[model samples]
Each structure stands twice: as structure tokens, then as C-alpha cells.
Target: MAVARHVADTVLFEGYVLYPYRASATKNRLRWQFGVLVPPSWTAVAEEHDFQRTELLMEPRRGATLALETRFLHAGRRTVQRALPDGGFETVPELRLDDRVLVPWDEGHEEQVRLTVAVDELAGPGVVVPFTRPAAETTEPVTDKAGRVVGRLVRRREEISGVLRIVTGELDGPYTTRRLSVVVENTSDWTPAEDAGRDAALSRSLVAAHTLLCLDAGRFLSLTDPPEWAGGEVARCRNLHTWPVPAGEPGTEDLVLSSPIILEDHPSIAPESPGALYDATEIDEILALRTAALTDEEKREARGTDDRAAAVIDLADSLPAEVLERLHGAVRGLREVTTSGTPRTPAPAAGMPDLGPAAPWAGAGGADGAPRPDTPWWDPGADASVDPAHDHVLVGGRPVRAGSRVVLRPRLRHTDAQDLFLDGRRALVEAVLHDVDGGVHIAVTVEDDPGADIRREQGRYLYFQPDEVDVADPGEAS
Candidate 1:
């Protein structure tokens, strides 16, 4: 559960702040872009959603029970008020006292609701858990070094309401599995005025909403890659706005995280990550280095923006040399080459000799220990046995080489959306290539395309694996 929490936290605060972390940044103006559940009244005007649905397959044993935890952020408006000379205070965007600065901003408050239910109880109407958080306001007097009231900070939160509904149904199949569905909806009754803007809606919305499920005696199946027997059942599960994936440590199926962001099974944080920068998609090393280079004024503004932003500035300033080095990069899963000059995996084809214990550019001799400088490893001309112009690959037990015709069948998972348009299109094989990873690729040009010759002359062609293409009619081969 701890490991899963780390990933969930990352998803929760993703895009909470962008690079620079300053409130003045244009990109930071529009926040809370992920997993937002606005009120039902605003749905019609804004085309935004008020609910999120998550469905998953679970196999439970006798007396199996499930625990669910719903987490989100409650937004609040923070305004800075300046002390008047007489007695009244006026609203101000920024207030400063000594070295500290305060700015008006929308802050997020973390909220969580948890409940445990027995598997047997979810058979009929299931269960409904209604939760609400009341609105509140607080004020903090900001005083200068002279102990005189200089200004004050006012924070106000709007009432938030939501509901979590869970239901289960027995799957009709040979396997004893059941489909569990959970829906999180914002039931706040507040309706905005005619001219109410996004700020008004955000105050009552559930920001960054997500759910975590833990089973006491059951295992959750993987929707991305399910067993052959349960493939049909898994396909029928309808997940909307959110995706359910296996969580916790690798190989642990007792916990599940349904998040608005799509993630692979068993997602974990990188060890080199120092802390949350809010923008999870950016490289940490780059963000840290860039953050460390901010100007003094920029850093000050960032710190005064929000507490989280201040923490980020402090982290960048205090990172140790050793920790910064670790953030540079780390590689994993590469097999170690044996000292006897043989790789654990199979050697390359007969013509391409292994480079032995030393790298080809190490100034050492070839695998046979004979000096050869004219043909460097990087130059393709160094290998006389390999020629892409005449190379051939087997497809459907038929040889497919240069000038051969084929029909494209790009895979949905591996190919982009635009590549789907090329499906069933006839193409002329231009060449066969092999990557350093030993994967084969077939380059082709659309046969009916008017610019086929121009593209071929420019040395540009669409590439695909053998399985993604089928041999055309023998008569069509040139």
C-alpha cells in the first residue's frame, strides 16, 4: 500500500505547478487540469464532467472483503488584505512585510474518505457512501518586526459534496470472477450565477479525484493483459474517464489504483526523483537544474506563491552533489558481457563478428585481436556481408525483399493514429533493416501515392515489423 501511495500522490499533484513554479507564469494561471469533477450545474455551460466511472474485474474467495479510499483536493481562495491607516482593511493582491511576501492564490486542500465493505453485501443494490466537507474561513494577522499589524491573510473554502457508489455482479463464465464498478460523482448542490466563471466552479469541484481499492482475500485481474479465458469478460468492463490498473509492488494483485491518468501496471516512482515538482512528465534532472538557475527575484516570487512551490525552491537550493549526480541518469536490465568475450545472448549473424571484451572503438583489435582501423564500427560500409538494398525478410513463409509488394496492416498498439489510415494499402518494399536491438524492420512506399518516387529518392519510407504487413499478390511483385 505504501508503494502504491507514492504513485497515487504523483498523479494527485500532476500539473499542480509547471516549470518556474511562479504564479506569474502564464501556464500556471490555468491549474487543476486533471481529474476535475465540477458541479452538475456547470456541466451544461462548460461541457465539463461531474462524475467519473471505473470498472474492473476481481476474483474473490469466500468471505472476501474490499476496502475503498477516495482522495481529492478541495480548492480554496486565499486573499491578501492590507491594513488601513484608520481601522478598515482593503483587499490587495500582494502584501509584503520585511522579507516575506504574500500573494492571493487558489490553494488546494487534500481530502480523503475511506470505507470497508463485505463482498456479499455488494450483490444487489450495492452500497452508497455520501461524504461532505463544510465550508470555513480563517484569517491570519501579518505583523512587521515592530510588532505592528501590517496586513492580514484571509482564506475561505466553499462547501464540497460528493458520493461514491460501488456495485458488483457475478460474471457468467467458467471462472469464478466478478465485475466491480465504482463511480465517483460530485453531488454539490451549489449552482453558479449567469456570469459565474471557472473560479466559482472550481471552489466547489473535486480536483484531482482518484480511488484506491484493497482486497482482503481476492485478486484483481489486469485489464491490459488478461488471461485467455477471461479476455471476453475483461473486454466487457467499461471504464470511463478513469483507468483501473494493478498497484502496489510488482506481482501484488491485492491492491488496485483507478486513476484519471493512464498508467502501466505496478507503476512506481523513480529512485532518483528528489521530490514532487508537480509536472511529473518533465525530466527531474532537467527541472532541478533549471530551477536551480532561477533568479533571486524569481525564487522569491515562487516561494510566495504557495507552500508547495516554496518547498520546491528549497529542495532545488539544498540538493547535495551526490544526489544531483544520481539524478543525471541510471540504466537497468542490461545483461553483463562475460569476461571470456562472449555475450549471454546469442552472437550476431556469421558476418558480423563480436567485438569481444573491449568496445570496437576502444583502440583494441577486433574479436580476433587483429588491428583494423580502415573500417570503424559505426560505418556501415565496414560490414561487407550486410546490404540493405538487397536484404530480404520472411513474411507468411514468403520472401519479401526490395521491389516486392505488400499490404500494410499497422498494429493498433504500436502504430500512431495516423498510421491506421495506411491499413490495407498496397506498398512497395524499399529495403529491409535491422536495429542494434536485433529487431527487423521493413521499409516501404505507398504504391498508389503520387510522391512515392520523390519520397524514395529522398531516402524516406514508412517502416513496420514483418507482422504488421502482408505479402501482396505474386503478380504484383516487381
Candidate 2:
């Protein structure tokens, strides 16, 4: 399921992908383009444009031919980059004024420009030759605020098309061995005054779209069911974010797709290889930091000052088998040592209260071994039942009702959107719903969504099992 991959990538990159993963960063606040199918004319009103579609003319046992047709608005702009103190640069539009003009002259005009295309990694080694044709361009004029023409801005106002024909007949197997990405790049750079708008390719963007096409759809792998090497990648992708198509918009079939291919990182050949960062995830200086306080020497030791762990992880294929084994052993030893020394406590299950003995409604067994019949059942709230025998049907170690505050703790194995449920975030209980099996489902409005993005009117909320949340303290929630 390409859709699942989109969803997982949304999760994996959420918060962490953007620099400074804090929620306060406005850049990380919105889901960019996961599961989004933008029409060719995205800048105009949504109703004015029809959904763009790509056709895959595929046949069984034989290779299929696919066409990538990308159409986008190309504006022209003259810009330059200025360096920042943080060692990065920001793009600034180049602005200049003409003093030689004695009379008012209109510089704004429109013209046509040509675009070249480049196709990348479309086929396996020695197979599937791919080519692209130059795009037919057009131009428009840049006008001043007073309606005086300042300069002519060239625009590639039409579709730039490309075709890729897959020859499965030449391959040894029934299908192509690798996934391919079709990148459409606008090679031409157009310059115009600030009032004319930016270049269609560079200003708006040079690379219009990169389409991912899978040959022999039935033989392809599903993003929803990734293999073991890709499991962690898949999980992270799910945790990313996704956007649904507008209600009346054309379906995904009518959109270009570019999804990340979950591939295993290749091993590095040396300790200081370029891909050393790839090893940082599973083993690196971060591992030492995760452990308890350590002196500088200990931290360096934990980081494998020699970079043996990183080399082994990144350059596994290039090293001798025995040498690789030694590096692996060293890493394993460090992991064991660091993890063994770390202190941790078991987290209590959701909805289970730590009720000390002095409570008025303690369980039946009193100080003595005999059962106490007079003990009253704990009353959590209205619209719920708290039977000890059926913990499954209870919420927050007590019953739940409208207006109760609960936390979200969806299980990983149960729901795909479990990642969407912000763990430990308090939500107001909207209702205690029951299913045919008499199972309890608590409807909750996330505290962050005071406007109620998911509300009772839609029969929607972050519904969860009783064990998924604990009761919030009244004073604290208030």
C-alpha cells in the first residue's frame, strides 16, 4: 500500500525530521504533503482545476510503458543568496532601479523559454534506457504597482511531458528488480525584476515532481507490509503524518506519487566514511549520552573512540569477516555494559490506580484474610461500570462519563493511527460509547484541539480502550 508508506513516513519524520524538533517551531507544526495529491494548477482556486492523472499501460509477464506528464505554473524571478551568521544562507530577490530612463517605460513583458529534462535511476544496471524531451516554454510580463510594465518574465506555462517504457522481456526475471523514480527538472534559469514574479522553475521550484512508478503491480511489495529490514523504517513512516484528499476532489489515482523507498544503508569502507551518520541511529555517541553520567574518558570509550562500531555498521561489506566480527563484539559489549548500568522503573498500566489501604472503598479483602461484604464498589463517575472482574470494560480504574478527563495511550499493535494519539496528552471525555460486545469506548477531544477537530457531531473523536488512558487529576487538568 503506497498509502501506508506515506502514512508511516509521516510518523517517522514527525517532529524529529525537522531541525529543532520542538512543537513551537512553526515549520514543524503542519503536515506538509503526506498522502497529498496536488493538481497541476494548485495555485488557482481548487474548483478551477481538474485532477492530474498518469497512466501505466502494464501487461502480465510483459513489461509496461508509463508516461510522466507534469504541468505546473512557472514564474520568473531574479534572486541571490545572502549568508547568515549561523553558517546558512537565505534567498533574497535581486532588486534594482533604472536611472537612465528619461520617460516612463514599461519593462514588463512575456516570452517563451525552453526546458530540458533529466531522467534518473529509472531502471536497473544495463537495462531500461530512459530519455526526455525539452519542454515548450512561454512568458508573461512583470508590471509595477502603478500598472507600468517593468520587465518581461518568461514562463513555461504549459505541460512538459516525458515517457518511460519498461522492457521486462529483456530482464531475466518476470519483473523489474528495482523501484524507479522519474525526476523532472527545469534546466533553464530565467531572470526578471522583483515585480515580474520568480522564474517558473527556480523561483517556484526547478524540479516539478519526481514520480515513483512500480512495474508489475502484483509482483511489487506493499508499503503496509514491509520486510524485516524495512520494519523500523515502516514504523517510523507510519508515525509521520498524512493528509486526506479534499472530499470532492479526484481520488489518488489521478495524482502523481513520489514516496520514499525504505532501503538498508550500505556499509562504509573506512571509519570516517561519508555514511557514518547512518550508524548513528543504532550505535554512536548518542548511545553514550543515553546512558548515565560519565566522565569524558568514559564517554569517549562508550562512543568507541576508534569509530570501530560505526565502521562495522557502515562498512560491513568492505571489511574482513573476522574484523567485522570483532567490531560487532565490541559494540555488543558496550551496549550490554551501558544498558546494564542504566536505572529504570516499570511504568504502571493505564487506568490502574495505586490505591493504598486507607481508602473507604478498598477491594473486598480487608486487613484480615476474610472478605468484607460491607465494602462499597469504587465509583469513578457516571455512565460507566467498574467491576473488578471485568477490567476490560472499565476506564481509568473507574467508570467514565461525559466531561471526565482522560489521557491517550493507544497500543502500538492495535491501531495504525495509534501514533496520532499523543501519548500522555489529556483530553476531555465526550462520551462513554458501548459496542455490540459490551466493550467500552471513550470518546475524547484532545486538549490541544479546543475547537474540536474531531467532535461528537461526526461520531468521531480519539476513541480508545479503557486501558489506553488514566484519569486526570481534577485540579491539575483545571
Candidate 3:
């Protein structure tokens, strides 16, 4: 099983409870989450915008001494470097508590938590409410009139939203609870200078760019089920969140942008990478790559070795020059690390596989006129096959005949190794028949057009289209 990462550090933040209530004891395995907002320092890309809306899930602690830790992430900064010049903070139950929230003084700090503390002490009254909500939001950092970095925006909300059940306890009378308006406020701070022109302009652009990017990306991804998520607007006015500029104090100004920002963590949208254009096709394995992780473009200019040159030349024709150039380079780079018998490495451990592996064989029999021997299925050499007719595998309301050709459309997948790529790539397949052999739909054999052999090629692999693919007999009506 993949290990869950537990991040810890020091950091400043702003956020609060959406709604709070006394969680009933009957709430089995009650989940506690603490989400907060932090400031953004640099862009996710140069000339490209990136916003920070950091959130953390807080678990119930045993004592009064509550320590909050957060995952401190910076686009390109090293953990050690950021810790030196500017220390970091992990989110916990420490920030605010009706002004009476206190912690042990470690040397010159009022932050660190001591050994053991009481639950009531750390979670006094409604204090634990804001500290435990799944949230992640960001505010534009304040810049000086000259466009240099200046101040930052802060937010503190004490609202709650949850359900209540008597569970065995009785209320004095009909109890009432409140829910915060879905409308969230977009806020940041700015030092109003005598010449606030640059400051004002920057602020406007920041908000406009953020709103435009979020809404535009959200809509675009919705078209094909994008892997990344941020925020969005809802149908009702409740989605209209009320926000204020930190220094502006409840008053709004230029570049005002508001919408529900849905924050999430995605492996597909690695903070250091870009989006992909094509789906699973071997024609150009460039979509899921992390360019920033590369040293430079010069290193990208790779040459095929004698062993690989043949494979390159073999696959060039259908590959298109640009595609071959990239795939060949990628394969060569991984030759040393990837073993011949072993499958590809660094595959998206989370996303559905472009091609699934065969299932273990249930039979204990073997060929060559030998006696059947009982053996474990895990043995790689074991063969597994299933009879579709008996299994009720449907095809035209009946079992499909063997060795029949049925045109079908594949789900969107980019077979290319690199993920962050531009569109118009294709995946290849060998002409075959229908059968569930080796516990897989062996009828379809996905192939890769190496692009290595083609001279001055200008072709692309297949891309997915929902309304396009159909599975019918070769002689059937169109």
C-alpha cells in the first residue's frame, strides 16, 4: 500500500469554521478537518498565475496542548532554503481563540505546544470549530506601488455548517443552529500609498486574472473531466460569497473576483507541470511530463544508441518527425532504470491504467500432453481464459463469435510516457480478434508508432471522441 504523507512545518494563515455545533458522541469515527488560507509568493509559472489556498484536516487531540502543523509547499523552493530565511509553520489548533488562545513560550516564541494537554484546553468552547474544517484558500499578497512584494491578506471566519442528531442526549428545548452563507469573500491587504496607481493596478489584475483563470479552467476541464480542480460558482445566490480587502475593511475595490473556489490535491496536475492536450496514444508520449524537473532543453536533445537506433528507425514512418524525436528520447533516458522484463516505472499510481494487466489463471492444467498439476495463479507464466458465452458477456444482446472484428472506441488515455503535452497525438493497435484470453480482451492489441523510422513524417496517433467510435461487424450497416 502507498504510504500517506504527513507534512509538518510552521506557517501563518487565515480561515475559520463554516458552522460549529457540539458533535454528538454517537457520531462514530467523527472526522475533524482544519483548513486555512495562506499567501502566495510566486507564480505556478512565469507570466502564468498560481494561487494558494492551503487547508489541513485536524484530528482530535487528547490534551490541552494543541500543535498545528501544515504542509509548506513552494513551487520551486527547497524545504531547507525556505526554512532558513523565513521559518515555516504547520497548521494546528493554535492561531485564534477569542483572544484567550495561548501556548507555551518556547524561548522567544508563543507557538510550540508542550508535552500533554487537555482536550478542553485546546478545544475550549467553540475554539476547536474553526481549527477543524477542510478548507484551502489564498489571498493575493500586497505589493508596493512599485510592484514589489509588500503586505499580505488575512481572513478569520467563525461560521459552521453541519447536522445534529439527539443520539441519546436531550436538548433543553427545540435547539437552533446556523449555517454560514455559501458566499465566500475574496480578501487581501494593500498599503495605500500617496501614489497608489501601481498598487491599485496590480490588485485589479491579480483578482481579474485569478477569477478568469479559475472560471475558464473550471469550464474547460468540465468538458472532458479534467484531473485538476480549484473552485467554481453555483446556481443560487448563496454562491455569492461576501469578501473584503484586508485593509479596505469590508469595502470592495477594483479587480473584484468571486466564485466558489474548490480546492483539491491532484497527482495529474503536479504543481511543477503543465496540462496535456492528447489522451492515451503512443504517437507522442509527451503529455504527462514534468518539464521543470528536467535540467534544460540541451539535455533533452538526445541521440539513439546502436541498440535503440533500429527501434527508432522502425517506428518513424507513422510517428511524425516531432513525435519520434520525443518518444525515442524518453525511452533512451529510461533504458538504464527500466528492466526489460519489468513494466514501465513512475506510472500514475492513482489514475486508471490505460491498459489493464491480465488476471491470474484459475486452471491448474498445462499443455504438452502432461498431467494437470495444481499451481498458484501468481505465477506469471500461467494462462487464463474465459468463455464469454457462458459468462454472459454481452455483445448485440448475445455472445460474440470468435475471430470477429468489432470497431470500438477507447476511453481517453495518452499512451505517451510524458503527461504534460499539447494535443493531436495517437495510440496504435494491432489488428486482432475478440476473445478474453489471458484474462484480458486480447482481441485489441494496443501498438506504439515509434516515429523513429519515418522520414519527414507529419502524422498523429488516434485521439478519443465520444460520438465517433462504434463496434459493429465489418459487414454490418454503417
Quick one: best lDDT, which candidate?
A: 1
Candidate 1, 103-184: lDDT as tens digits: 8889998999898999989998999999999999999888888999988889999999999999999987677799999999
Candidate 1 has what TM-score? 0.73
TM-score-superior candidate, 1 or 2: 1
How do the residues 154-214 of candidate 3 rate in per-residue lDDT, one tens digit apiece? 3222211211110011113232111112111122232334554321222212221111111
Query: What would you estimate as the lDDT of candidate 2?
Result: 0.35
Give lDDT: candidate 3, residue 46. 21
Cα error, candidate 2, residue 113 (Å): 15
Give the whole-model CA lDDT for all candidates, comma-separated.
Answer: 0.85, 0.35, 0.22
Q: Which ten residues in a row have the lowest lDDT in candidate 2?
A: 100-109
lDDT of 2 by residue, 331-397 (tens): 2111101112221222122212223364433455433343433333222331144432233335546
Looking at model 3, residue 252 earns an lDDT score of 14
Better of 1 and 3 by lDDT: 1
The candidate, 2 or 3, that scores higher on TM-score is 2
How many residue pairs clash in all the candidates, one count each? Answer: 0, 33, 69
